[model samples]
Target: MASMKFACIVIMCFAVVGAPIAQAISCGQVGNNLKPCLRYIMSFWGSVPGLCCDGVKTVMAHVQNTADKRATCNCLKSMVAKIGFVPWRAKSIPRECGVVLPYEISTSINCDKLEL
Candidate 1:
């Protein structure tokens, strides 16, 4: 009986804690998708790489709706925040890659501000 009760408690704890993880966009995923573009995004004097454009398209393709777009923007903002990237450089990533996104990838973007 005690073991069963413990199992139930553990399940409840996991359910509560894991819910957000399931819904939230992860930084690691974003990083992986854009990893190939890192050099171009960081550098001021280089052409956008072909792989970088592919990565941008793949990442943008996943953003199918307003919520996904917001989450992706937030995830990207977090990534740029950690790396101390130029906001304009980040904003120009999609454009430079010839990919259009619903929201601009600027530092000032408010994830929840606009709806698709």
Candidate 2:
């Protein structure tokens, strides 16, 4: 009985961990999805238009341990960047990703500013 229960637990764990990570559509209704993040960066960097999409993408890409987590985080972060005419609050984006958002930041998700 114990062995059977253990097998069931393992199966459940696999099913939970094996779920596919959903992808996000880039600012479907907005222009140049990077604009918002860039805009936010601009305000901080003396209104300079160059904000660094590559840096943002890299930070977002490493936000997770798995491919799914990376993809999902990337999408959510991108959305926030685009929407943030000003900087965004860290608490907002995590809700979209269904994550608790540890205080530690990853490579691409440098949205520490509460500018929004």
lDDT of each: 0.76, 0.45
lDDT of 2 by residue, 3-113 (tens): 999999999998889977745333342224334444443344433223334333434444444443444444555665444434433333334344354432233564443
Expressed as tens digits, the lDDT of each residue in 1-116 for candidate 1 is: 99999999999999888865334445577778789877776777677778878878877777767887788888877777667565667778778878887777766778887576
Pairs of residues at least 3 apart in sequence or in different chains that clash in candidate 1? none
**Whole-model lDDT for model 2 versus the true structure?**
0.45
Instruction: Show pairs that collide, candidate 2.
Output: 37-81, 59-107, 59-108, 60-108, 87-116
The regions of model 1 sitting more than 4 angstroms off are 1-26
